[model samples]
Target: MGWFYSIDIIEGWLPATIWALVAIAMVVLLVAQRKSLKRAGLQIGIGLLSGALGLLATWLVSNVFVVFGVSLGWPVIFAVAAGFALLGFAISAAVMTHTWRRVVAIVLIPLALLATTMRVNAIYGEYQTVGSLFDYSPYPHISTLNLSLNTISVKDWNEQVKVKSRNTSNIPKSGKLVHVDIPNTASGFQAREALVWLPPAAFAKHPPRLPVMVMLAGQPGSPTRFFTASDTVKILAEFANKHHGLAPIVVSPDQNTEATRNSLCANTTKWGNAETYLTQDVPDWITENLPVSTQADEWTIGGFSQGGTCSTQLAPNHPNIYGNVLAVDGEIAPTDGSVDHMVKEYFNGSKSAYERQVPRNAIVNNAPSHQLMILGAGERDAESVSNIKKIGDTAEKNGWTVFRFTVKNWGHDWHAVNAVFKVALPYLCERMGLGNANVDFPTDSKIRELA
Candidate 1:
């Protein structure tokens, strides 16, 4: 079973255990009183019912007062205080007739209140530190859920910053041009844009078209944002300068939209045709403007996060275009969809629909060509690590060539993504038919190497 399912089991049993303990305690209390079995059973049932009612009242009061921020005013507080005072007086009168009963009530009441207070405080603290829980917690179950939710929020903020920044700074100047826009196909919704890097060496004796690497951004992100935010431009420059002026042209396209949070880089009704936009439209545009190799083996595609998922999906689907696919911390499968939901969404209301789009299904049914596939996840990223391992296992079983790497203590973030890129770049370059010559480094390197 999936780890999430295991968590569900724990959630179910915890409440059951608590209730069982309450029931057992009631039974012991009645038996210690030397009550008849029938009388003891009746008392236990009434106690359980009373306890349940008290809990329900507490829940309602807490929800109405604390959660909704509603005020009961001084009048209600005074009334409650007076009522509790009367109840205490009545209990004290009854206890005066029995010393042992008084002792039991005195001992248990304070302890119960203390336990309740501690439980409340613990829950409140957990909610307060929700954002930092992933960083603090060592428990895989809690950390995974926390990180996954945090990642989505972080990505949302990052995308907003990216869209704004890219529009402001990366727009090409009319007079001196370093960047070119690849126009969209007949469908205006889907277009590819390529950014070419001419590191002075490209205009050599026999100016030859350079190799190309396509870098994809995360969900709700554009390629321009990757260049602006991440050190894509710097990395390319370093790689090019180190490889004796052999820097591949980098093409980053706008591949995310609202309909599909991830886009998966697949052709789906929810998201506009991203595959056509990237594979067909973008390549055609690149071949026209950039002096880059058009050979299938010369093209390398890589992405981070949702972009990583896209790279995995697109490379195998259209192997003729992408020679190498590097996916960094990608979701192996869509997790939110239930089996029934999957059947409805993909298969005309049938489970058979999962046969084609599911990554494992595809690998098992038809293993694609010997395209270089590199999958990496952070050791601290429980969800991503598990998903990566699942993909690796599927690939291994299917006899598909795969390279899997797990970075230590890294969660699902840019650091892990960059780590994957650093390791995968050389391998990807080699697969893209780039010569194995050592990259030449200038005595004084201008670009900052990612740590």
Candidate 2:
């Protein structure tokens, strides 16, 4: 069952084979219905009309009804419309006079839908494997921090401690994923179990100090998506393999307690004290519990989508906490509802208070500091790209070093997250004094796969 669940549904031969079959079925059905030209015309007409309706429905949901709140964007809108088109074509073709043709078209209906689903999934890149699609937990969830961790002193991390060349003969090949609870002592935010990824260097006989990354999953996601959806562990491990297992020890702390909940990553009465949890509680726990750098420059705050928006908001607001920011497909501002509604609900009806929490405002208000803000978004996700660019402009004007890029042919999905994070890993490692920065986006064959 595990192996079955592990089957790749995005790119590999499985999806390819499934798609090939779907195409063949469509072709066969169209050819069989050639004699019934009138019926064929009607099927095509229905498919076209359905596609138009799909676009209208999508527009209504995204704009008027506000089902998803934000625009699903053109790519997602088109994908949904294509699905409707396929379904319409299949159903119309099925209502033929011939019994065999009807049966074939009936079978093709489910196949067509499944293929459409795959197409949409490809666009989002959310569910790479069946296990991740359904979210199968592989590790035990512990609600307590490890007591016997080799702790780091705060004052010792004043200067950058480079990861000097050392024998990695005893180092493990990859990182270990640990699911543990970070006690929300200060913030009182009821967060879910956080995830920790320790590189092979962490398990070494005498582990050198490593940088820490406080990664946050999307609003509608959990820490587990770092592994299941993003394949982040593998990407980090690949980088670690080249640098004697010296990648940052990434900890994905929970921002939103539940999948559907949106904390807005703020210290508010409406949601939870997410800002306090991230900036204080989570950092304090890391300093005391993990063998990580206590230097703020060595720490990174990053996330995807809502989490991305959080990173943009938090990193500059608490610059002493995080010097590096990696935000992928983030919103222009965090919003639980309409601007006025969010102001009322999350900011006690103070529009000025809500304005302060906006990511661009945070960057603008922040004093000139030695910070690195990596603003990223998928090319297809135009809204996010525009949003990040706005934030990037603010960050640059505020005297922060900014590296901004967009992954072509990707959208506001895990695929974009994986690409942005993986490509930036080498540079981030170098910045944290890991030595030898290898820009692996277009040059490295492995990293190129992300683009």
Candidate 3:
């Protein structure tokens, strides 16, 4: 009967009445032959083994059909049920031959029933739709400005450590690491750090200026954070080495300040004008010390989390300077009014002025030309996933090119963002005319596929 159902059910799957009848018959047969089956331990074991093999075969067959783009329907469903049922009956029969077999069966039966019930409940639960996970009722307060910068600096808070440059003796070394220093700007202050991985071939022959990718760190730290995180440095170095000798010179600048918990990479009275520092002052510092290409397409900007938001904001506003923007789980909205107020305070009590600076409004009204937008979020990260979708939708509606992905079963964390860099970096390279349109998968491939 199980074999018959397993094949025929693929097309005209049996009705509920037939299922009930079959179940009743199976129960009756098991009870009626209980005394005779009691001595058949070998038979029970064989039945269980055969049932498990059958279940695995059914699963494999279904997978094969799916791979070829076909549907197996209820044959697959009945096969699973019959397989488990056979296993349970076999195990029960084998245990019942022992002295405390009844006690074992009593416990095992309930457990099996409970597991089945939970699986059924979970399947049904998936159908119930829910509201947006990101919706916060009492929205967080946004601070546009602040009255004081009196917060005590942690004495033990040394700046992030730096990575020593590798000897690229195989290639020509054209330039060296110049001094790292801070520059006083109109808004607060700015720190400029540069790395010149010049191939020796450049200096020996014709000295050619190289492309540059200005990397930004998200909130809660400085550009030095990337250095402290050795993985990021290695990734950037590998990216630079690839595309011939056209690897970008990376600029890591400090944009941290006292008035803000972390700079959103915007010009603000609260955070002392980060936008000016990054866009204006840092670029000037780079051009002065380093042999960097002045072409906008030669420059790319990318970051994770808050830094991603900053890159998105800065790239579009200064379209002539940045050609690539990669944002991972960036907060776009003003929350309640904290961001607005923060901007307003920076601009001397002009709350309405904050509207122009938000990334949502900016992109919708004026999408940048020669822009490469990459956004990534995890399926498990409900809020970030929704926000990333919204960003993608906006980009699509505005006729902007965007590479977006939601990794399965990941959460709002760096691990997910790092996984996304495999796709993001190549996309960035393609946009900058540095590489062909081939997507690169990460070596570790940390993300899992969802069932």
Q: What are the Cα lDDT values of the candidates?
A: 0.52, 0.79, 0.51
Candidate 1's displacement at residue 401, Å, is 3.0
Candidate 2 lDDT, 1-451, residue by residue in tens: 8898889998898888877887887788888878878988898899899999998998788667857655666777888898788888888888754678788778878887888788878777777788876766666554342333553332222121243323345556777787888999999999988888888766654466789998888868887776677868888889887776678999998898888899899977787798899999999988887778878899999988998999999998999989999888899998887899888888788887788779889888886867988878887777887887788888878888887778887777887888788778888887887757445433321112236
What's each prediction's TM-score?
0.53, 0.86, 0.53
Error of 1 at 182 (Å): 2.9
Native-to-model Cα distance after best TM-score fit, residue 385 in candidate 3, in Å: 1.6
Pairs with steric clashes in candidate 2:
none
lDDT of 3: 0.51
- Stretches off by above 4 angstroms in model 1 are 1-180, 186-188, 191-206, 258-260, 334-355, 397-399, 437-451
> By descending TM-score, how would the candidates be arranged?
2, 3, 1
Better of 1 and 3 by lDDT: 1
Give the distance in Å from residue 378's predicted Cα in candidate 2 to where it truly belongs: 1.6
Ranking by lDDT: 2, 1, 3
Better of 2 and 3 by lDDT: 2
